[model samples]
Target: MEIFFTILILTLMVSLSGVAARIIPFQIPLPLVQIAMGALLAWPTFGLHVDFDPELFLVLFIPPLLFADGWKTPTSEFLNHGREIIGLALVLVLITVVGIGYLIYWLVPGIPLLAAFALAAVLSPTDAVALSGIVGEGRIPKKIMAILQGEALMNDASGLVSLKFAVAVAMGTMVFTVSGATIEFLKVAIGGLLAGIAICWIYGKSLRLLSRWSGDDPATQTVLLLLLPFASYLIAEHLGVSGILAAVAAGMTITRSGIIRQAPLAMRLRANSVWQMLEFVFNGMVFLLLGLQLPAILETSVTQVEVDPNVDLWMLFVSVVLIYAALMIVRFGWLWTMQLISRRLLTKRPMEFSAYTLRDLLIASFAGVRGAITLAGVLSIPLYLTNGDAFPARYELVFLATGVILFSLLVGVIVLPVLLRGMPRMDKTAQRHELQMARAVMAGSAIESLYKMEERLTADVEENIDADLLKEISSRVIGNLRRRVDGKEDLDRSLLAESLERRFRVTALRAERAEVYHLRATQKISNETMQKLLHDLDLLESLLVEKEE
Candidate 1:
């Protein structure tokens, strides 16, 4: 317990420190860098060793990360791309599993096809952390990123479900009949979906009721929202269903019906900040822990296993590497075929997202780096088979998983970016064209408003003076319109103008609250102090709102 706390403290300090920014030069992602740091610490000479309960890692990290991702995802966008997201999440996973399973079995020959299938299943899902890092801040097209994120989110459930089935087959705990497997799959999948919706609905309604009377304490609201994900997960898992799917479903439900749809502006902002912070810390820990576990995993293997000097570890290593390539190749093939189908039938004219050419296919292929879900499933593999005998190839399976992660990180992160660079760049002219299209939309609305005003004031106008005012208004409107349409007014600058205006007001309110906090933190602040401070905060908040207008 002491060791665990120490490691946690170190991880927290490293993540919160800005030192990582100086470590990487070429737009390397923070997660990847953190993992590298962990690997470095795990080296024999470095002598920093950390061990974690795999179960604890899941309990601590996975739920919040999944929930945060689910909550922030725009439901409307996800719904619009539901078909494509489902295709990638469900169908693509199966394709990688079968394809990689066959390849590994063929290459290794010693490992059973079923064991290979289990490995493949573990490697099928993509990492949300990896995807988010690679595609930063809507740098990619919103629709494309939405599909990627949505797929990554759902695939955690689908891949984990598939993994449990693979493990069952491995352990031979459950009899494998085609009909029985089908029924089991339905039970888990359908059960998860139903459980998620039910819990989310109830929880969301509960939140609405609570918020109505809770005085909207931002910290309190944030804490309740954080608990909802874990509670939903626990309930579903306890009921022998997919906790992951339940979490996903509940998140979607809450966002759709609770906060995004109904919460006040301040509440939404508060919730967003809370989720973002949780996401940051959770990701930092994941990569840090991932790195820290490397040495321990090696030490455990060396200590537990009796080594045969003649055993061909190289053969196993080579075979797993080949299998990793096969997984990626299969992913690419599936994505390409899907993209071809979508292009021909569904999407009419897709534009490039970011500097990448063939954005959809490349994003689909490169985005398949497996992480936490895969690691969890692999680590959860039972130690003994159904016959009360030792499980086959257990340690080798762990090595194989570690190999997959390393290979994916090395190849996917390093190679994919290079591949994407070759794609066409959307230059200044193209961006200007998009801006013009947006301005046209705003102008059309403004013109409609003017038409309504002209209709109402036609009879009330005393000819000359009224005509002059109308002309001046029209000219002013046209200038604003042309400034936007012709790209004469910088979009970023214009947005900054509004942002600065809002920021000033929010700063003043925050200052008043900060003074209250200072008083409380330094000593005992009385109820009088609290009440007066709140009154000032309330006035400042009103001023802030007025400034927003």
Candidate 2:
């Protein structure tokens, strides 16, 4: 009962924080605000302490978040930026581990090299949630967004694998050998990848079977979709592979297979709403949990410092600052070096080379804000090694990890906006123009198909089909396409008129949707009937909006 109330209170807090973020006049990021709330709640005076179970956190939160991100990511864009993403996700992660590992080892006395590397691995991956919060519908280039997202998705596997190796060495489970560790890492990573692909394939086939059996039942479909990420994670982990990567692969498979496109409209709509809510709640809870764990982290750090004469708290603080600085410096340096090399080698690929710029490099550097993954990795560290002795520098590493996360959040909130200030917003006009042109081409193709259908029809069937209605529909479509394509004064006027009509229709549909909700609230309509009507209105509104755009 106590745990149930605590959870309810936390959920209320999350909801209020979300509301406050929207209504508050300040420009502070929502995650930062939520973290502050969490800190306050966890303060000794409040007596609302919450212990973070790292395993539970990872199993419950990470897979769904990663899966959602992967599902939403544009497959074509992901492929286009594949090389750059690999460099950032895999190569950059390894470099951060090696470069910062040695630096931390040198700076902090009594911390083993493997432990230092473990800390580095924990901080290497950029988090999608943090990135989304910082970027928040801002005008950052699409390419930059794609790269950031892709890096965040893929780096989890690399970073976690490195952490696994480092932990083995730290715990005396395995001796560190460069060649041996490299081989193990490859085996683990490749195995995880293959496992994820196989699992996704099986899941996809199962979904198809379920769809056939269930016959477009949105509730059944949505429930099955919800189970997918967890299933993938659990299956991969059981196979001793990267569950994070498995979740990601499962999501990408769903996207690639066009399952989302094939799903019934109601199922897609309901699933989207459910996923969005889940993302909001899970991400909110993560930061709040971070806050709740702060007191414990600080107490541990203090206890460790008191017990060890050589452990200077002030020096540890300095090391934290230095570690953060090294992260930024190394990230920036690598990005610049990669761009330089790519420009030279990919001379013929002007499209690829031309996208790299100083502004983008800076955005990418600052965008490396660590979040849930770092928290999960650091907190998951066992207190005792295999030999039953306390794990060396565990408290110090957790404290440092927390410090890095806070610093990154502060920088993201304060620095990122300033960097993005002068950048041009995405060109809606150009995008709409391209969409219109594509529609015209598609309409032209449709007309050809209609003519073929007419040729196939018997005379009696053709008579019953209403030739005048068909002719009118085709003529109207052709006229609209010509007006859009020609872009002359009269045609432009016609296009504008059509757009205005669509805008008016969309507005009316929105009003109707509101009225339907009001009826439901007033109990004038049954819930089922209201939902069915609302769904229809939503579909109509969406179609109108798309056409207008």
Candidate 3:
């Protein structure tokens, strides 16, 4: 019962955070609001605490979230910006691990090199999810946003893998070598990618067989779809590969597999609705969890600093600020270099780094917000070594990580809007043109298909169907299809007529549903019958309302 109550409270808070974001007079991002609410819950008076188990958290939260991002990612754009993304996700992460690792060791007193690298490894990855939540959608230039998102997707794997090696070396479980690390990285990364693709292939086949056996059971299909990411992660982990990358690969592969498109409309609708709800809940839980940990994390760090004679709280804070600044500087420098290299390579002409606007460079630099993956990765560092000694400077590592994450988020909330404003937005005219073309093609194909369907229906005349009634319905459906492209006055009139018909249909559905309910109330119809009727009405009404919008 206590467990049930805790779940309910967390879910309620997640739901309310959405409402509170809109209700508040000032604009605060949803992630921040949820974090604030969490801190409030953790107040001394409330005394709410949830134990943080790093391993459990990773298995439970990371896979699904990464998978969802991979699923939603536009494959075309991801591929198009492939070079830039690889630079940031793979190369830049390596650079940060080395660069920031040394800086921390040099600047901080008595922190181990291995531990510093682990901290750097975790912080190297940025959170595009938090960025979108902070900046709001459609605000960032589309090109920049695409690259940033791609970076976020790929870097999580690289950063976590690097941390694994660093920790292993620190614990004397594995000896580190340059060549060995490279070979292992390639093996794990490639194996994980293959694992994800293989799993998704199996998923597609399973979906097909399930449909054949059960005949379009939407609930069963959705349940299977929900399991894909976790299956990919666990299987890859068992194989001693990068489970993070596996989850991502599964998501990306499943999207391209086209299984969802082949599924029944009801299944697709239900699956989309369910996934959206789960994504929101999971994301809220992450930020809220971060907030809940804030007070305790701070208290622990303060105590450690107090006991340790080497460092003071103020100096520790200085270290966080310096490290964060170094990250931004390194990030901006790399992005600048990448721009120059890309232009020189693509244009085949010598161009300066200043070819692009400083606004883009600055925006890209500040946009690297350390978020969920960072929190999870840093916390996942083993608390004790093989010899049972506490992991060196564990509290300090956590403190620095949390500090940097918050600093990045706070800086982004303040600075990003200032950089984005007055900058010309990315042109989406090509996208609009493509959408228009797609609609035209769809209308033509639909009309042609309808004609063939009509012929087939008429040819089967053994039953002596009503020919005129069929023709009237076919013409009306064809007229609706023709309104797909926004063009002439006739098209506009057809759309207006369709809109009016949709309203009438909706009204009729509501009336029918009310009648079904009344019959059930009066005992004129069985409860099951009333439910079936209402469900049918709701589905039809859903279509009508969708079209009206």
Candidate 4:
């Protein structure tokens, strides 16, 4: 009951913060506000304390977040930036782990080299949730956004895999050898990829069968989509592989494997809504929980330092600052190098190589704001080794991890907006024009198909169908196509007619819905009857207004 109440209050806090962000006029990021609220509530005066269970956190949060990112990512864009994404996600992660690991060991005394690497691994992945707010709001180039997103998705798997090896070495579960560890990493990564593909294939096939068998039940379809990430994660973890990667792979598979294409429109709509809500709630809770844990983390660090003089809290803080600086420096340098190399090697695609500029490099560097994943990794570190001794500098590790996250968030909040202010805004007019062109092409194809089917339709359904209504609808569609393809004068004339017809139909449907609601409100109609009428109105309105290209 206490736990339930805590969650309820936290959720309320998340909601309040979102509203405050919108209403306050000041451009404070929502997560930053939520984190502050959590910290204040967690103060001693409020007596609020939330202990994070690392394993539970990972299982509950990581899979769905990764899966949603994968599912929503533009596959073509991701592939176009594949080389850069790989460099950032895989190569950059490796560099950070090894480079920062050594730096931490040298700067912070009494921490094992491998344990330091573990800490580095925890801090490595740029959090997608944290980046999305800034990236979405900023006029960052589409290509850069794609690379950042793709890197965020893939790096989580790589970072976690690195953490796994580091922890094993730290816990004495496995002896670290460069060659052996590399082989093991490949095995785990490859195995997880294969497992994810197989799982998604089975899931996709089952989803298609269910859709066919049940005739597109949105509720069932939504539930199945909800379950997929968890199932994929669990299956991969059980196979001793990267569950994060598996979840990612499963999401990508579903998106690309015709599963979503085959689902009913209503089911897709419901599923998207469900996933969006889940992501919002989950991301909010994670950041808030990080804030809630701040007090306890600080206290643990202080106590540990007092008891053992070797555990220097100040040194850990300094190490965090240095490490964060190193992260930015390394990221900027690596990205510049990759761009330079791509320019000379790929003369055919000079535009792709030149797309990244100094400004972009700066934005991308600061965009490496660590969030939930780092928190999860640090918290999940085992308290004791196999010999039952406490993990070395555990509190320090947590403190450093938390410090990096907070610092990174601060950097992102302050720097991103300033950098983005000077960047060019996306051309809304141009985009609308392009969309119009595509819609015109689609309408042309649709008209061709309609003509092809006219004979069969007339022969089979002429008696049942309303031929006049069909002709009017077809005429309006043709007018819409003309409005896009024709001159401004012709467009205005045809558009006015089509617009008036659509307005009349939509207004009638809305009136019907209002009448149904009024009947229900006045207790003149049964709830079931009101619902049925409202549903019909909704379907009618959708048909009248909904446009897809």
Candidate 5:
């Protein structure tokens, strides 16, 4: 209870501080500011004892966060950029592990090669929250942001797998054979994929059943939606499969499987809000844990110094620099390769992805900080061997890893922001114009459809009496619609009409989707089921038109 209150208070304080910082126009990252606050409060003089469990840190914090990320990602964009995402997420992680590990073994003589690789794997994944400010509500093109997000997502799974492999080798549980490890990796990946698909399919079917049988209570439905991700994760873990993958798969399935279709609009809205809140809370907690773990990690490393304390510290410092430099170089090198390949592929067409500019890619490379999962994996490193010889350099490794994290944060949160400050801000005017054009096009199309309907009706009626009143009414309606659609010709002028049209189109799309959802929810319906039903309805409407004709 005391811990819970303390956390709540700290969270509130951070929220307020972030708000205040925006007004004060400070350049510091909000997360760094939050961490500094916690560190200050937890200093020995202040004497706050905040210890978070490693298992809870992994299970409680990671799944929902990852699921939220997957849910919010535009699925279409993810599908489009799937290849580059694979390169960055999977291939780049392997590169970081191999490159950084070899550098560490050479630079720091005593460290085991496998352990160095493990530490490298831990640091490869980027933090979603850290990049939130840089990505800035995804103001960059959806394709670029999707690649960033998908890479981050997949790397979380890959990093965990690599950490497992490294620890197994470090502890001598399994022989390190390239072929054997490759086979095992495939098994784990395939097992995870199958488990996710199965769980999401079953769970989505069950949710649809609930919507059919239960009373139309939006709150209850919202609660059920909230539990879906954690339930999928827990079930997968219980079955010895990858819970993270399962959660993501389940979220994706629910979104795509007509579960969202069957849901009430209010329920869907509430569920989105709930997930957003959960994402924020989990993100804050993960970073706060990162900050709190820093002091202890430092203390442990300080106590582990053996070969001439001064010399040992110097060696560790040098190793960290070498590892960080190696990782940055590899990240940039891969990104440049990707850019060249992409340019060649787009020879016939102009590239649409924003943030591919060399400056942004450099910023991305430096932004590769070890975040919550990295810390959790490092912290979860087994402390005692089966024979009970303390895991070799466990404290030292922790310290070294923590140092790398702090360095990455320092470079990522502190230095990169300053460098990026000079880059061009998002083109607000261009974005507004694009949105305005989209609105005008949609509104004009609707008006043209209505005119066609009016013309067809006039042809069918074949009546000219009382034409004056009809003319007045039609003229009034068309005039109003014309004014709404055509008033925004000057793109430079701020147009409320465009804003209204944009909003209206969005709401109309949502309502149409909601109706389709209702159709899907009504039973074991297929696409043909809805299509046939709609076709019959359309045929009946046409028959009525023919009878009037």
Candidate 6:
């Protein structure tokens, strides 16, 4: 009962966050609002103190979110910016781990380098989800956003892997060596990617069999689709590899899968709706949970500071500021170096992705905002050493990491808007043109298909059927397609007419949906009938919305 109640409460909070975000007078990111709401719930009067199980949190939340990101990312863009992504996700993570790791050790008197490296590792992976939430969609240039998203996806694995090595060394379980770490990293990374790809491949085959056996069952397929990330993560972990990368790989792989391309329209619609809801809830829950933990984390840190005369709370905060500054500096410097290198060494002409203006560099630097993954990784640090003693500077590490995450978010919220202020909203003119061209082509082909169907039906149906009626219906359908292909002075008017027609149909469909719901409420219609009607309405609405976008 408690578990169910908790779930309902969190879901309510998630919904309210959305409403509240829109209701407020000024603009604020949805994640921040959700986090604030969570903090409110943790007030002393309410006294919500949910246990934070790091392992469970990672397993329950991380995979699906990462998978969704991978699935949404453009495969072609990802490939094109592969070099930039590697520089950020791979090489930069190593740099942060070593440089910031040492900085943490030097700045904080008691913490060891290994423990510091662990903190650095967790901090290295930026949260692209949080970035998008903070910096509104279409606010950043397409190319930049693509690289950032790809970097975020790949860095989760790299950062976490680096943390694993740091932890192992800190715990005295393994001796760290360059050659050994390199070999191990490759094996784990490559194996995890392969694991995810292999799992998804098998899933595609299984889904095909299911389709053959029982026909298109969207519910079953959607449920299976939902399980893909978890399956990839668990299986990869069991095989001794990076589960994070495995989940990401599975998402990316599934996007390129043939099954989805040939999937039934109903299945695609249902799956899209399900994934959208899950992404919203999962993302809200992550930030909300972090907010919930904020009070406790602060209280505990204060207590720890009081307990140890050597540990000053003020200095701890200062350490957080310093560390975050170092991160920005490192990010900016690295990005600038890339730009310089690309200009001087790579080519006389600036590389499209590698070259950047000062403003662009700042945007990229700040956009490297940290969120859920850092929270998960930092929290996942083992509480005790092998000999049962407490892990050194665990409390300090947590405090600093949490502080950095918050600081980074706040800074991003402040700086990103200003950086992006004057930048024109990404021009979608070319995209609109392409979409129009594709629609014209599809409509032409559809007309041909319709004519073929008409011919086949002429012989198959009763010969006594009204020939003029058939002709009129076929003519009406073809007329719509004909408008798509017609190129003349009237093209603009034709588009306007189509747009207006779409709007009218959408409005009517919505009215019908309301009526159906009203009927269901009045017991004039069965719930099943209402649901079917609603589904049809929703499908039509989705099409209209897609066309408008």
Candidate number with greatest TM-score? 6
Candidate 5 vs. truth: CA RMSD?
10.7
Over the stretch 402-474, how does candidate 2's per-residue lDDT look in tens digits?
A: 9999999898888888889978888876666666667656766766776676555535563676677767776
Q: Which ten residues in a row have the lowest lDDT in candidate 1?
A: 348-357
TM-score of each: 0.76, 0.90, 0.92, 0.91, 0.78, 0.94
lDDT of 5 at 394: 67
True-vs-predicted CA distance for residue 61, candidate 3, Å: 0.4
Give the C-alpha miss distance for residue 410 in model 3, angstroms: 0.9
TM-score between candidate 3 and the true structure: 0.92
Clashes (N, CA, C under 3 Å) per candidate: 1, 0, 0, 0, 1, 0
> Candidate 5 lDDT, tens digit per residue, 455-486?
76667666653657666767777776676467
Tens digits of per-residue lDDT for model 6, 16-112:
9999999999998998998898889998988776788998999999999999998998788888788889999999999999999999999997788
Clashing pairs in 2: none
Tens-digit lDDT string for candidate 4 (134-213) = 45643676767778888898898888889999999888788989899889888878787778778889988898899888
Scored against the true structure, residue 497 in model 3 reaches a CA lDDT of 60
Q: On a 0 to 1 TM-score scale, where does candidate 1 land against the true structure?
A: 0.76
lDDT of 5 at 124: 79
Instruction: Give the Cα-based TM-score of candidate 2 against the true structure.
Output: 0.90
lDDT on C-alpha atoms for all candidate structures? 0.71, 0.84, 0.88, 0.83, 0.71, 0.89
Alpha carbon deviation, residue 413, candidate 6 (Å): 0.7
- The whole-model C-alpha lDDT of candidate 2 against the native structure comes to 0.84
Evaluated at residue 60, the lDDT of candidate 4 is: 90
